[model samples]
Target: MSAGLLATSPGGDVLVAAIVVPVIGILLLWLVRPRAVEWVALAALLANLGVAVAVLRTVSSSAAPVAYLIGGWQPPLGLALRADGIAAVFMAMAATVLVPVAIYARGAFGAPGERRPMVFWTMLLAITAALNLIFCGQDLFNLYVALELLTFAAVPLVSLDGSRETLKAALRYLVFALAGSVLYLLGVAIIYGAYGTLDLIGLASIRGPDGALLLAIGVMTAGLAAKTALFPLHLWLPPAHAGAPPAASAVLSALVVKGSFFIALRLWFDLLPPERAVAGSTLLGVFGAAAVIIGSAMALRQARLKLLVAYSTVAQLGYLFLVFPLGLGSGAAPFESTAWTAGALQLMAHAFAKAAMFMAAGLVYEAIGHDRIAEFRGLGRIAPLTVLTMTLASISLMGLPPSGGFSAKWLMLTAAFGEGAWWWVLVIAAGGLLAAGYVFRILVPAFTPPEEPIARVKPVVVRREAAALALAVIAILIGFLPLAPWPLLAIGRIAAGAP
Candidate 1:
């Protein structure tokens, strides 16, 4: 199937279930106590995972987008929910990561009768629903609604503890997200005025562009970049992502920002001309380079393990932007390029590896009463499994051999050399080194033989450690992806401007 090859395919109903299950769980959570809510949400998540897998299989089997136009009405007048190969892949990835996070959170938040656990479950399910909506949404306006829901669900998670610092971080995140919304909304209005359609597929059908079109795209990109916390606009990220509970931090760092970044990907890759995309891709790559440099350096300076992991997120996210210049060059099809596959790998690798690292950091905090890196001596002895999880995750993050990050960077470097974008190769190499520095900052102290057995804030829980380890293992498993680009990502990519 080529681009624009959507149909009202079989298994289209799964998309609705993927979204609706979480929403129903969130609603039911409000009326139930913690234990029932936990069981209900956990069961719903498992069903959602099954639905995600089904959607992916159906899309892969047919090699076409599965579209469910609301009421069977066409675009430009009616909304549509469409799942292409990319959406299906991301949906499966989200569900895969979320299941373990749910398990780990069950241990952290305690039994379901507590106020915080109830609220956390609600937000978690809500985010699951919002992310599904964003991925499936075929209309720009419909996606904006999904974005708003995601922001609302994510912001409160940062301040779950109600500490002054965390509250401030949440507030700061909210303000920036709101500004992004306003800018995005204005761009939507402009696009509708100029093109008379807010549907992605419909907009792609238009040929020539005017100033209004360019302006709308430009403003929309800026808005999304702010929401994504790319480079200079990333002031709110470290604090908010670091301040949240470990499970919440995992969601924010691993998946929440990806929501906006995915929209930006759709705008540039799916909607824009290849020629137009080149310039924007370069601009984004430049910012990405800066984020790698600055964010990595900041990560190395953090004395706290959680904050260090948070800044690593800033650095790691930059890797996604590098696909533009590297993929678009070398006279290759954009979707077929090594850089494109490498970027997708980078995203998945970061999600799993980073989630494992953050969860491990939380385990460290729980056992030791704090995450101060210098004081982590003997952690390796006290909580060997969690330490092992941290080591595996750090290896992935550092792009070490036999890890997903290693494979991704290797592919990207080959593409960079093939395209003569060797500058990015250097940037990627340096980012790895910085990642190593921070990883060392944690591991060195943690492995040091203690003067005496360290006092524990609490006994280490095996279930939580196993959950964290599972995520780390998944990150390593991604290293097995073939060195060549998989055909999966290219399933529905059509020529630019082809209606």
Candidate 2:
């Protein structure tokens, strides 16, 4: 055992609270009145958000990982939950996004004693607990369990309305996710058989280009790609996200897919040697480039607002995988490179922007009674705040200046220039143009003048509008980050060899 890896840090108990508080809220839901479900869920999530921020602060100040070993046992014999810099960032991002989502959902799921509200709140809490595990898990088997919990929690939200189309979509999502799980588990088994240890730090110390290790990584990456809905394994995402309730769509799109993607990052950068994975990293980049092009084209063709947003998610996710090739190919510690910072910024930016966009879509549907893009003429007049939310989010999604998307792409472009990787440069530029095309498709019709005045079917609450807009503004605020490699991201990264 690496002695450095076994010691728990001060304030490490916050990690335990991050997972436990939400679980407690899940249990409290049944005991509270139906109307109190929203209160219980919100209180727990708020507390969880504070915990996430505390973890980030501790890691930032200490410049090291914060860890808590379960039962004081070491890895391979017992489990450890560790929060490295990247994990702290992911946790903080997830918590920040979840709070706004919970607030926005109150308008829809806050009614007293309703079955749907109960189910939604319960699943929301379940997802919170599962995501905490995913960020803190230190071994493959534990990560697999967290992934399964996230999948199960998210699937019910997809079919919450119980419509025939949604049920079918939910089933498809579940099946594909389970298939991914099987492959992941198989990889974990192979790793244990070959290395006799599953702890990430332990694996990193011994990782090599051994055939068994290579095979395990291949299968595991394939599985995580399916779970993350990376094209061409992305068929399940559009239907599932588009058909769900808007609040659910926000969570599914912004955070759930990221859980799997985070594990993929750990696998490729932590458990595999970067210098040796050149070919594999490039292959992953190729798929990401394909996802950017094809996913954007599909989004441009979607007739409904929600479906357009869903496909946009598929396109946005492609940028993340590009970091693998850009960082690993740079001939530097992947975690210390600008590409790595760009990828983290991209993830945070997309979470806030996409969540806001989905909430706006739901509000649009509520006002106009339909989400058909063509029928959105005069949307600005009927629901100006919702339209404003969409516009602000689009600014980020289109990679415009003074927004998170812009900073991420700018850093990525700089990294590509440094490496003289012109092919990737072209892909990044083209992806931005295509993103602009789809964003305009939504904005143009919404701003168009109606032959006659359009009336709202239902009134939109100011609280919900503020909630969505707050998320969008945060996406923009992230642009203020210096367009360079972040030192915080480097903390504890070398210990596990994670980029």
Candidate 3:
């Protein structure tokens, strides 16, 4: 292990709490009366949010990685939980999305002593703990365990309604997830056998262009890509995400897949020798490019609003892998590059925007009793707040100015231009145009006048509308941040360099 890896930082306990609080909440859910389940889940989520904020503040203020050695033992002998700037950002982002989702979920899963409610709340807290662990875990094997927990927690949410179709979708998701898990575990075994350690920092210190290490990284990348639902490996996402309840859809789309993607990011940017990964990075970029075009085109053709948003996820995820070629291939440190910051911003912006979009779709369904895009005439007149929420989210999704999506894509375009990778520039431009096409497909019809009067099947709650709108507004507000590579993102990274 690196010498610095031994020292535990002052606020490291916050990272522990970030993971532990949610687990405690899960336990309390079973112990407490069913009447208090919602309150218990909400309180735990709020406390976890506090821990996320504390870790963010501590990492930013100190400008270093905060490490918590398990049982006071160093790596190769024990485990460690560490949060760097990027981890802190991701943790806070997950918590930010979760709090509102818990609020929005109250309608569906708030009923006391119900089986679905019990399952939903338990899985919600499990997801929270799993995500916290994914963000902070330093050992590769430990992350595998975290990833498995995340998959198990998420699978139940997909089948919460207990419909035959939903059960099938859930099973399909499980199969894909298990396949990915096997590949990932095999890679971990390879790494451990070759290096005698699974600690990422220690592995980085002695990493070289060895065949075993390269092959292991390759296998691991493929596994994580499947779990992340990246293009060509994304057969399970649309059905699973679109079939779930509205709140579940938001959590799955906004947060779950990101856990696997973060592990992939660590593998490519943190563990591998930079020079050895360029060819593979370009290959991943190819997959990303295909995902952008194909996924958006598919989304444009979708008749259902929820499925459309889910396909949009596949496209948006494509933009993330572009960071590999744009940042890693630039000869600068990946953490310091414009593409890196752009990728991070894109992740944050998409999480907030997509969550809002899913919530709006759910509200539209609630009001009209269906989510068919063709029948959404006069949506603006009936549920104006919900339509407005969709509009705000669409702004971000289409990469319009003064929105987070715009900022991220703009930075990516700038980086591609600097690298003279005009193919990526074209990909980015086409993606924006295609995104506009799908987003408009939903909005234009909704705003159009109906042939006859349309009555809402149910009244939409003002607070739920506000919860979703708050997330959309945050997505827009993120655009106002300075359009530059952030120093905070590079803090505690191994490759801090001028891009």
True-vs-predicted CA distance for residue 78, candidate 3, Å:
0.9
> Candidate 2, which segments miss by more than 4 Å at Cα?
1-5, 494-499
Model 2 per-residue lDDT tens digits across residues 1-499: 3532577779889999999999999999999877778999999999999999999999999998899988888887888899989999999999999999999999595457988999898999999999999999998899999999999999999999999999999999999999998999999999999999988887888767788988999999999999999889999999999999999999999999999999999888777876678999999999999999999999999999999999999999999989889988999888889999999999999999999999999999999899999888899998888899999899999899999999999999999999999998999999999999999999998999998988789999989999999999999999998888998887777434432
Reference-based lDDT, residue 186, model 1: 89
The candidate, 1 or 2, that scores higher on lDDT is 2
**6-38: candidate 3 lDDT, tens digit per residue:** 667897888889989999999999999988999
* Residue 122 in model 1: lDDT: 89
Residue 496 local lDDT, model 1: 37
List model 1 lDDT by residue over 251-318, tens digit each. 89999999988888887777777766678788999999999999999999998889999999999988
Which residue pairs come into collision in candidate 1?
3-494, 34-112
Model 2, residue 439: C-alpha shift (Å): 0.8
Computed on alpha carbons, the lDDT of every model, listed in order, comes to 0.87, 0.91, 0.92
Flag clash pairs in model 3: none
Stretch of 10 with least lDDT, candidate 1: 1-10
Q: State every prediction's TM-score relative to the real structure.
A: 0.97, 0.98, 0.98
